[model samples]
Target: MSLLEAVAMLAYYDPDSECTVMREVPFSDSAHILLRFLHSRNFQTFMDGVPQITDFRYTNEAMLGIVFDDNFAPLGMIQNSMGFLEGGTVVRKSFPQSDLLMSIPLLSDLVGSMLGKGPYFIANDAGPSPFELGKGPLYRWANFDEVGTQDDPLFQDAGGTTTYTTTENEVSDIRDVARVIFKGPLNLTEWYFSTRLVADIVAALFPFGRDYGINFLHGDKLESMPKIEFIAEQGVLSGGTFMFLPIPGERELIKGYNHMDVLTACASLPSPGSARLRRAPHWNQLATTIAIPPLLVPAPAETQTSGVADIMETIEDTLMPSLVLIISYDDGNRVSNSQTGFFCTPQGHILTALGGIRNSPMVNVKTIDRGVFKVKRVMGEERAFNLVKLTADVPASQMKPVSYNRSIPVYGTQVYAVTIPGPDEKTVTALQVTGTREIPGIGMVILTTPSIPAYYNNCPVADARGQVLGLAVSESSGGAAVDFIIPSAVILGLFVGATPVSFEDWEAREMLQGLDNTYAEAMRLLWLGRFTAAAPLFERAAKARPQDADPLYYAAACYENTKQAARAQTLYEQALKADPESVKVLFSLGLLHARAGRAKKATALFAEVVDREPRHAQGHAELVKLYAGVRNRDLMQKHLALLRGLDPDLAEDTLYEIESAGRTRR
Candidate 1:
């Protein structure tokens, strides 16, 4: 007899020795399908008789492993409970889970009491998945729990012939593998922590933890409490608040962010690893409540938003909150005009129009959300540009400050004009670049856009891609449609010492993200009127879309808008190199040269555009303006005819061109 047959005979004392052998056929796809169908039917039949106690669903994931054996794994450390082919670390990789499955509702009731202090567990069972239940839990915390002795007998089951007292231990032994072992409350209110709980958790589940409840506000940790208050009251750091769990060693228990961080660790555990299996928190619902913005802003659960809603939201998040000061000045006689002042520095400095304040030492200013601060002092001013820096009782650290970009705006770029037109209306108008004027010593061409107005004078102009391009001045030269912008380069240079950054150097050195979200956000913030806030976003965006010209264009615009003309000029040059045929880019490049008093280079670029597209009105108009500056009347008239032919109204309103014709030639 075969060894297998002999072993079966020895173990069972012969398995139907006289049984007839059945002939087996080759398995086909249809046979496999039939077998699967039969197996499923059998499983269902067996399960139906088992009497459902609970849905064996999991909220946490685990690794499949077995007891470590040295014979199979010879090269290993004594402390290594488990080892895989690779040992590496992931930094802030795993995100909070989404779309928790709808539950039939069973045994996870005690899970809340098992984990330490945080209430996230009670709320995280957050009902059902949006797809299945039509709506997920808005707040995961439940209102009530079960009472009395009416518990399931399955949960009350105990092993090894002994019925444990309290029935809690008996249920826990079964549930412990799927939930955290309770270690009591962890209050953040005091300096002292219960080290006994930590020791117990470590002893019970070595090398890792499930989750720990933590307190916020009243029970805030002494070390972390001070920093958050400094921000909430001072406004130094922006975006979401992040604090780590007090886990020591190379491995952290889990990094916690904001108040919700106290919920679950969500760390991956090995097989048989003790844990508290709770549903992952619905992070998308709670991102805006934090100090720093998260990487992935959750999309709407039901319907998609048009681009406008998203832009509005980004603006509200970054700028609206800090635009607190209701700054008003008087032109003598009870007539007072008011405009909003934005925080300019982290130390409470405010930048507004020099003319707006009218150099008044004392003005009434009210915070956006707080009480007013009077007797504000004028810290400094760039009188030449009508810009002023003021100091208020309020510190910049108490509010979000506007960040500046090193690049400047290009000619004809679309921008957002932030102004107050009505008593109750905080207006943001979308405007387009009308023209550019070059002036020596200013370092950048004066940006003229149709978006400027008398009431909006001294207000900020932001690019469509999200950078404050310039501050609108009252002078439009002579063109009725013109709003001359004090270029961003001159602005930055006026206050902060400006340094021009090269595209190659910036792109080569700056770290980039795996996705293009930074680029997307910076572009949107343009309309939201947060130039300073948009600068780093643009930098990150620029670094991310190195191959795309638009991101660079936006970043460059930020510089030009902030008055860093030279930096903006270089960035535009790089953009033009990337897209040689871009007429708009070419025209802006020429405008930059013209602003810096380099008419020859400016002339070449304008000539290139006008030569290629005779119908291009801006190109023809720029050439005429440049020619007029150098007394090249013949060249001027040649393009003047084209400008008039392409757009008669624009040709007639050429006074801004005449006024900004450039310095007289030697």
Candidate 2:
């Protein structure tokens, strides 16, 4: 079995392109106008990627076909044609030399025009027999072929599939036959595929349209895929370009394989092996390998860091100094022995375990320097973080208070218990917060860590940078030792309160409300495919909320669609500066690069988007196309795996496209 390890594209139609020179035709005349425009270079580009396809690599103009329906089923087709985009109109006529044309004489192109036309065309030059046998020539190209008398041999072509047919004959009186039924530059979010075909061609047009109930103002990867997008204007018909990504050997192509031959062979352990056909958990599926060898944490190859202990010791050296020891007293008498505490505020606030406070009226706080201090008052406490907030009597000058780290530690960051074993003898040891658990009934977050002595409780847990976390609670029950610590953020939340705003703030509030309303309305227009209308609204919203990048970004996109290139570039740059981390902005800018044929810049932008967000399926999907364009099979496979990791359904559809399109080469 051999699997294709490359990108395969069928047709990539740009839904935003302009094709119709005329618009606003009545239902009676719409189909005729639509057919007339189908002979355009722009439509041909949509049908076959490049404009003016004089001769298709796989088939000629007669083979290039299309069928249209009214947002539902197959209607009719104009097959084997070409268009001449001249003088603001497409005139090169389509003469389908099929069997159906022979039945209707006047229904075909003008009979007088066929004057001395040839035999090979779709009968644009000729139609049903004007003269019967024994009178003149019997020339009817229908279920039977040829423009000959009884002596001519008959040829049979399938008669069932052909529907409505017409010629690109310039009919000056067409406008009198038509009225603009629907004036558009409207966008419809819908999906449909032609259900029937004449010769493997789309026999349906705009079958379904999702009325603009927009779901994504955010760049949601999952919601964007698997839907059909229609961007229509009065006469020019445009639909989104659809591509199917086929993995190696999934289809009945001449070549298929064993396991997908990607550079990262290990991916097979997660997803089903592409070529190997082996069963495995999906990448999203968590794995449990109890008895097997543990996977070591991967570090930068350039860094010489070896063992967990070395790395852990490095982390401990930073966190130990910030932790302090606390001893509680009941009614000014020594009650509890040494406990743990850490600086929680700039103005001498100390945070300790609620259990350590034991509801004691007073407490003694000591630092690693053996310096002692008095507790002024108990400020606040929380059960979830297992913490009590206390104000110390000493000034901030004498305290080396620790601050909280807002970013949560991911599963495997090396954490340490900072404990003072004796006066002036502070210590730190490598510990792991292996996972977490919910302390049922108590509503507390209990972190699961490696075991340490009971004394470690009431002690602050710190990461490699010495940022103080919340109090670590020692296990009251004796058995297998497990350590749990509260996060400092949760502990700090105990002291937060909402501030009341006065009526004087109304102007500011009203301005904010205006920005909010403008942004919302602008988004509605943007989603509705009314870019020209939405552009100014978005600018107003952007001005109202200068710090926000979305309004500027969207305004720039709207401007670009409206052909205001200079203004679009300026806004895109401003949006990029405002929020450098926005992948949506990056992806949009990357699309600009891709459209300009700037391969390097486009790849860089797309690469950055995926780098910032691994599961950005659209980013990865675009990369797959880029790699395929450059014929970089390795890179293509790499992103193909990432896309599969993100979404398998999309991958399957992509594979179907690779196998289904004509002119496909493995």
Best by the lDDT measure: 2
- For residues 99-177, what per-residue lDDT tens digits would candidate 1 score against the true structure? 1211112212122112111111011121254234312222110000110122431111124342112211111111111
Clash totals for all candidate models: 42, 22
Q: lDDT of all predictions, in order shown?
A: 0.42, 0.45
- Evaluated at residue 258, the lDDT of candidate 2 is 10
Give candidate 2's error at residue 45 in angstroms.
Answer: 21
Any runs in candidate 2 off by more than 4 Å, and if so which? Answer: 1-321, 330-335, 359-361, 422-426, 436-449, 469-471, 478-481, 497-666
Best by TM-score: 2
